[model samples]
Target: MSDFLLDPDVVFLNHGSFGACPRSVFEEYQSWQLKLERQPVQFLQRELPELLADARRQLAQYLGARSHEVVFVPNPTFAANTIARCLSLGTGDEVLISDQEYGACRFAFQFAAQQKGFQVVEQSIPLPVESDEAIVEAFWQGVTKKTKLIFISHITSTTALTLPVAQICRRAREAGILTMIDGAHAPGQVDVNLGEIGADFYTATCHKWMCAPKGSGIFYAREDRQDLVEPLVVGWGWGKDKTFHRENEFVEHHEWLGTHDPSAYLTVPAAIAWHKQHFTAGVRQRSCDLARLAVDLASQIDGVHRVHADRFFRQMGLIDITSLQADPVELKKHLYDAYKIEVPVIRWQNRTLIRVSTHAYTSREDIQTFTFALQEAFNQRK
Candidate 1:
């Protein structure tokens, strides 16, 4: 709670949308930017590699990944694009994904599939998922002999449910299919071990849950599978035979994506450190507890229900408000305009849901305020 840099006047219940950075981490990001501006040539050309490697080391230690296995990207969308575009899947090859994927990433695969003459099959995982086994079994039904890759979300963006990604990845590997996990919402909200998950490719955003700067994200490709992918952006690192051996095609392809702002990526270490210093396990537990409270309170309203059990969710929850007749867009505007509470009301799979994202910045009072505002909105509708 002490580490968050959110404003006092605003009740930010939308941490999953775009995470707020800690003041200390923001300062560190600014310092990196200032240093780069001080001597652009020295910073970008001379010192950037060392500084980037240092940041990668810290992040890798925190995430239980090898520094070389992970590279900085602007967001998961870019990371997913790199994998989607690079893989040489052709006609008859299928990329299996879930209906719960983020829209942008889904589009990335769709576009790739279209160009590659491959199929992007969206397998639906029904609501009120019974268990990890049930979810995996349901997804497995979509796999065909032609299936080339299994793409899944570690934590679904719209539903806020944590899928059993590790089990699915293991199964995919056994079947000789590649696995790519979109972990846009996982990193800081839950403990992630890329080695244990054993996915061929994984992508996550630091800005969403790690409280890093806007553009910070990490893309992890398994060492063996690294050779199969091509970088989305071709840059100076493409052919440069430097310190880390350009032999590893993955490292050479994705790391240096033209000259742009590397300040956010450099400041990821500060974000990781800030979380350790202030937002401890106890704080995370408190935030999750409050989020559950909000879900429970909101579900008490007639025509509203919790999307899933507490076990399925981490720090965020989805409330199904599909029974309400009011326009979801209008309801969202009314909440923000009249109540000053910022939250997301999404329409997913023909149902309208309100997703509440809780983080260290959230207080019990904030949940109460959201509950009160929701009650008012429901009452007015009635």
Candidate 2:
């Protein structure tokens, strides 16, 4: 609790939405900002290329990927948008995605589909998942001869379920269909190995689970697929005769998207170090236990239950709260206003759920307080 910069009065169970950075990591981020202000040209022009390369190398090694294959981006959505627009999928073509993907990333594909006259097929992955085979088979049902790519999440946002992405990626590879994994919630919460997952392209937010500062994320394109991705922003890195800033075309194209603060991106190494020092196996297990406990306590209430099997969850768990008969927006507001308990009340596929995220800083007492507030909120409506 002392390590993180969070409000003491607020019971924050929403780390999945936006991660909390530790004091040490945040200070490093500030130091980068200070350095940038001290000398703008030297920092951005003379020094940024190698600095970014070094940062990407560290991040790449951590993710089980080659340094040249990965590049820094603002967030996963930005990467998603880039791919969505770059792919040449017109009429008679299709891209497959699961129903449980992040809303923003889904919108990017949908918007591109509308403009390009391509079909965006969303396969339904119903709750109470039985097995990894079942999920793969169900999602594979939507893939047809016209399907060119598959966009899926490593861990779903609303349901908080970790999908068997490796199996799906393997199947896609055999079929020659491109694979893009939206891993916004998977980095620090679960072990991320790009080579093991075998995705053609991958995007994840360091700010969410990796505990990096906001506006820091990664976009990865496999060596063979790098040429398929076009630049979302045509900046100094574009044009054939332009001087390359980095070793590879992917980094050179995406790294310099106009002059913006690289502080968050530079601070990712500090965040990774902080994670190494503190988030040990025992600490991670404790966070997962607290998440399960939140679901267990809420399950005792009538008509409330866990959304998925415990095997599919990590530090984040989703609890069905539709039995309370209250609007999700209003219930979320009431929890914060009345109890100072911060959690997300999500409405997905007509089902209301409370998404509880547990981290190293989260206390068992905090979960209990949130449960009590939920009980009181449910009773008030009756």
Candidate 3:
């Protein structure tokens, strides 16, 4: 509690939406900000290329990928927008995506599809997932002869369910279709090994679960797939340009985009270090335990029910609140205004869900507080 930058008065359980950084990582982020301000020209022009290279190297290693394959972006939305805009799609082309993907990413693809005269095919994946094999089969059912690419979430945002991306990637590869994964919630909460997952394009937010400052994310494109992407911002990286790092056209073209605060991107390694020092297996297990506890207690409440098996979630879990007969907005307000509990109540499709994200800063007492508040809210109506 003391180490995190989160407010002590609030029981902050919404780490899934925007992660809370530790004090150490936040300080490191500030130092980078100060360094950038000290000498803007020196930081941005002279030393930034090498600094970004080093930062990318560290991030690549953390993701089990090559340095050249990863570049820092402001957020996953930025990365998705870039990919979505550049995709060469026609009227017959289809992109198969999961029904549970984040809406922003889905919109990026949809917006692009509208421009290029393609279709965005969303596959329905029934909840309380049976097995990884079942998921692969169900998702694959949506793939058609026109399926050019597969877009899926590594971990769904609304449901807090971890999708089996590796299997999907493999099957996509076999079918000669490209795969793009939105891994916004995966990097810090789960062990992210890019090599093992083997998606053609993968993007993740460091701000969400990685505990990096807000507006930090990594975009990964496999070496072969890099040629498929066009730079979103036609910057100095485009056309006849002065090369900063001579690694590849991929890094040269995508790395620089005019000038923005690179502090969050540079602070990634510190966040990684913070995790290395404090996020032990037991600590991680405790967070998962608390997440499970939240779901269990919420389910025991008269009208709440667990969304999926415990195996479907890690560090974050979900419980359906449709039967609570309470408006999602009012329940969220009650949990926050009255109980000081900060949890996200999401309405996905027709089902109302309370997403519980437990992290290093969470405790059983926080779960109890939230559960009790939920109890009181429903009891009021009874």
List TM-scores for all candidates, in order. 0.97, 0.98, 0.99
319 Cα displacement, candidate 2 (Å): 0.8
lDDT of 2: 0.92
Per-residue lDDT for 1-382 in model 3, tens only?
9889788999988999999999999999999999999999988988888888888999999999999999888888999898888868779999999899999999999999999989999999998799988888988999999999999999999888888999999989998999999999999899999999999999999988889999999899999999999888877876785547547888888888888999999999999988888998888899999999999998999878998898889988899988766788888988889888888888778889989898999988899998888889888988
Model 3 lowest lDDT segment of ten: 237-246
- State the lDDT of candidate 2 residue by residue for 24-119, as single tens digits: 999999999999999999898888888888899999999999998999999999999999999777899899999998999999999999999999
- Tens digits of per-residue lDDT, candidate 1, 111-149, equal 998898999999989999999999999899999999999
Tell me, by lDDT, which candidate is best: 2
lDDT of 3 at 71: 89
Query: Each candidate's lDDT (Cα)?
Result: 0.89, 0.92, 0.90
In model 3, where do residues sit more than 4 Å from their true spots? Answer: none
- What are the root-mean-square deviations of the candidates from the true structure over C-alphas? 1.5, 0.9, 0.9
